[model samples]
Target: MKHNMFCFQCEQTAGCTGCTGRAGVCGKQANTANLQDALTGALIALARTIQGKQTVSAKISKQIIDGLFTTVTNVNFNDVTIQQRIDAIHRELPAGTADYDMKKVWDAQEDIRSLKSLILFGIRGMAAYAYHAMILGYTDAQLDAFFVKALCAVGEDTWGMDELLPIVLEVGEKNLACMALLDKANTETYGIPEPTTVPLTVEKGPFIVVTGHDLYDLKCLLEQTKDKGVAVYTHGEMLPAHGYPELKKYPHLKGNFGTAWQNQQKEFDNIPAPILFTTNCLMPPRPSYADRVFTTEVVSYPEMVHIDEARDFTPVIEKALELGGYAEDQPFTGINGGHTVTTGFGHGAILRAADQIVDAVKSGAIRHFFLVGGCDGARPGRNYYTEFVKQTPPDTVVLTLACGKYRFNDLDLGTIGGLPRLMDVGQCNDAYGAIQVAVALAKAFDCGVNELPLSMVLSWYEQKAVCILLTLLYLGIQNIRLGPTLPAFLSPNVLQFLVEHYHIAPISTPEEDLKAILGE
Candidate 1:
């Protein structure tokens, strides 16, 4: 039978290949997958139309960014919202615009599909960063212009690797700029994040659980609910909110409610609190707490309460009060059974202690740096991350971010050079911060970033990780370790090219990879 849909973008693809049946591994329905495909085709159509114009305006840029981000894995599963996006894109076209069938790209030669997938998925990740910055009143003309260029390139049939390869690296280059813009917007608005300890327990009282990576939305919710009886807790990617100075000051902004995004269906089911989704990583809601789930910004689902541009969170707030939370304090611990986690070791915080870190390395007090970070998912192979961190040498430092940190964030790794051994940089967008720290260390040691005794051990579940990986490659950083499995879209030839040029390796056991990385 012909496939109902095709998606292989995230880490949890079925059978280590694309999902091509009635439903995706993440529980996305076939129709939802079809709409996502249609939305992407429409974005490509919109890009083709925009290419003919003399100047691509900011309004057009926003539309392209919005459309791209909405189709990312676990972002939007609502047919109504996606169709509305399709209609809106159609409205923007001058005339005679038709969506380029995504099947064409999917059916292309394996190498071609690999390159194009890189372009398409890279931009999808970049779009999330651009959207976050735009919400905070920051926009880059160059960054916006590239969206039009990249989308148009994805639609071009005659282009080969010679034509598409540079664009892939450019996606990395532009993503760095986009990440910087988002980092600037966040730190300037919320104040630089500091090392803050966040409890996993949910305090007794009416409470709201806010998830996703949008800190601005969380800040707004904190403002509106201030002086009210409701308490607010961060979930998943929002866990880093506790480290921001401005956000942590809120008395009612209590702590994190659950672990990563994949566990939400079980964690939030019939819970006493309401949950708000500010951006992506939204699973299709379970019937138990579907009504209590609210969405805003680019996140949407049918029948769920959506907080619109007005940002009025009254509906979500009222639901929190109605639930009235638990009768008493409920203690929750991380996967490691620890009651608290530490975060907010952002670039600034890390750099401020640069001298101590440098001295530690010089004195052999710190042997190496392992960046064990990225998104988390449901697959059993993901346990590799927990084991890897557990097996790291005591003298090594671990820097992590994004939802993946939840795997072992609660573990007490002890101190290195007066700084916590494991430092939590903000969100995935804060990969810029991680880059900054790496560059500074390289400079301090008079060497290249890859030459600074630092290695990247990354786990990816979504497009955001794709873009970050591309950025590292663009910077000519080498010997990176990626797992639990390689992307299915990369055919043999393209995979060979990456292996020869970048030395990228599929991860093995914690002991083996650690020995290899440390040159044992």
Candidate 2:
């Protein structure tokens, strides 16, 4: 049953099993996938060499983070760059340290593989957050230290579930700290996000579309494009950038270009502006727009103009100016057909309204609170989220985050009490905000988070969602309904363990799941 390559870290993995074929569902080729594994193996070797030592350096720590981030779903599809990263890891490691072959972990026993995959993939997700935070000069010593330990553990063949399971949860606990670090870095750098409405219109003349989750990259592009006769538009997860005080201050940061990340291939096919991918969410570009693609940081695709660490965005800006956008303002709408979406209902914004939310729950104006959020993907059955939001019965409130909110963020869900029925809580990393909001509400309501009139019906597509789910489990939150499909990597024993301990279940139809939650 062995195919060319093996990967199941994303929700859209082939056949709900591993994508053990010529190319992954995300368009990652078999060769590139192997190179990513090689890079990870090298990084693990690097970590192992320095393990239990007092002198771990920051540059080594950052390379480990970058190396792990490079292997995440949809990040780097260029085998050339991946091998370069592997070479870099090799040069950085001490003399005679051998790279750990990843095939051992991949070909291990079923439950053993599953548990180690959780720890491995969970830390892979955490690396993205740590990378973002490090770029902002907000590094956590403990988080960096755990990255080394966890990578070593992944390559440690002797470690069983008893050892691996606790590390899996530790990945979540550290990821929480990592996320909080990134959150602090973001708010301190960009200011606490405020509720702001983002338009869906692309203004005339030259402009650039910036996708991916890196706020600093977008900030750099915004600064460079200002008054240079080019405007900037946010796409996918970058939609939340408009809510930050510093980011929103730019008048040239005009509008959002398209829907979530999954639709980029269709939406960017003939767009006049050049697209800058700052991080993950890159799919294989079509020839029509391939010339317009530019990548920065760890996101790389072959033949795309890769922006270097100097951060000079001249190529992207020139490409935009040359392309010359729409002749007139072109209006676009969300997946729900609405022309505007709102964001920045993050933790600070929500907790500021705690008194009102508490009183509304007390008065029965807000009947149930649903966290209908997580990564959105292109799989079939995703419309369940759309339908679920559409049928939320008006008395309930929907709190959403990540790109999945694009499913219903534009809809006029109206108001429950005085608050809007649907609230957009920024990017996927803002799950930290969602966590903080839930805990504060639980405190105000005088009960645990699981006992609050809140339920989590989440849709996941990648490792970021994995770490977040583990965080919820670590917090003892129960009964999370996850779909469009559960992770393919969860073996039967691991699934049973999660079900028995945390009560996580695969999402069924929206109506039936709603009855279960609302009935409770």
Candidate 3:
């Protein structure tokens, strides 16, 4: 088929293959997708050039990180913005080396292609965490250096599993450090998140729904809208905002809005209030709700109002007032018809209750722990997650995050050992919290995280998920079941490597996978 471009990097790719027409299933124009690929190629070339150089400045490194992350699915949907970033990267190079062709890496041997994809995609995800940490004044040299090393490895041909395996693990290892940096930044800036309950119903009157994965933006919005008669509610990945002491202190920071990222199109339809997107997972806006959609920081959509560095949110406030919302307190519920959703079960909160959790485990009150979380997408088979969570034994603890939780978050899974079996652990970025809890559990049992009676059933749809997966691999955590399907970008050889090294498997039906996971 003669197509305008190729874009299969996401779950919504056209025809279950690469998007080769005028626009992607993700609504990304062909030109924009190609430009993203070009930006990524330029980054690889820059990394290749600086592979052995020990004198690269932090400014150059930051540009490389930002440029790669900007190309990630749903991050930068605007061609003009991506081009500007490409030019910025070119300007940073020493002006002597030829630009590396990205198509070469994409067209390499299946094995090499797969290995490189892991390193590349893993770094793309890591950059997001690093960017978030950077915004909070946290930076790590080791974490920054890995991006360069991993990028250079993607362009290297001498690597096989024996050589690339460590790099793959390194992505996970470095991502852990990156996540830690972000954790420190977030906790230091917003205070440790405590257990918090966020309602699903939107309070009547003027209110703004803040989506995306940035806490600082949410904090800024809460600060700006204070005393303005405008209420702020978390949406999508922002559901965790209620946990942070600094953010929750705001009296007007109301409950969550909508569900997962994929459902935004339908959920936001005719929504009276303005919605501000602060990061990735933004879908193309529908006309009915387009006027109310706003972008801030790196998230940009055509024709949407964008709040700049000034961080002024007056436009959002005005729109909220204009919308007026519902005249009465409109009651809303989650997919499972629950009127409330609970979040903020972060590491600090979980570990504080560690004694209870350990006692439960020792008494056999909590038999198995399942961390069922990841990005949510439009794929049809993704219902497997909700079904999987539903099928979990009553004695199991279900810890979830990202948009994936929306599939089953509303379900009343009841409790085990005085803790809600289904625990919402904040957003995808808060995967750091899940890691902390797992580590604490292992420490309590005096075993490795993998050795604990814990399992991670993850579903990934974008780069941020990739970084978290890498962090998991880095810690040598094994027996993770990931699905609804593996990325087509992964070659068979690379798949074999992951299976042999980490015992990662594709998800099956809930019943079958559950038996396998539980050794039934």
Error of 2 at 6 (Å): 1.2
Question: Please, what are the lDDT tens digits per residue for candidate 1 over residues 60-79?
Answer: 88899999999888888788
lDDT of each: 0.91, 0.91, 0.85
lDDT of 3 by residue, 241-338 (tens): 89899999999998988888888899999999999988888889999999999998777776788889789988899999999987889888988889
Off by over 4 Å in 3: 1-3, 157-162
Model 2: per-residue lDDT, tens digit, 1-520? Answer: 3249888889999889989988898999998888888898998899988888765689898899999999999999998999998998899878888889989988999899998889888988999999999999999878888999999999999978898999999988998899999999999999999999899988899999999999999999888877899999999999999999999999999888898899998999888989999999999999989999999999999998999988999988888888999999898888879999998899999999999999999999888999999998999999999999998888999999999988888999998778898999988899999999999999998899989989999999999999999998888999999999988889999999999999999999988999999994
Higher-scoring candidate on lDDT, 2 or 3: 2
Clashing pairs in 2: none
Which runs of model 2 end up more than 4 angstroms from their true locations? 1-3
Greater lDDT among 1 and 3 belongs to: 1
**Candidates 2 and 3: which is better by TM-score?**
2
Tell me the TM-score of each prediction against the true structure. Answer: 0.98, 0.98, 0.95
lDDT of 1: 0.91
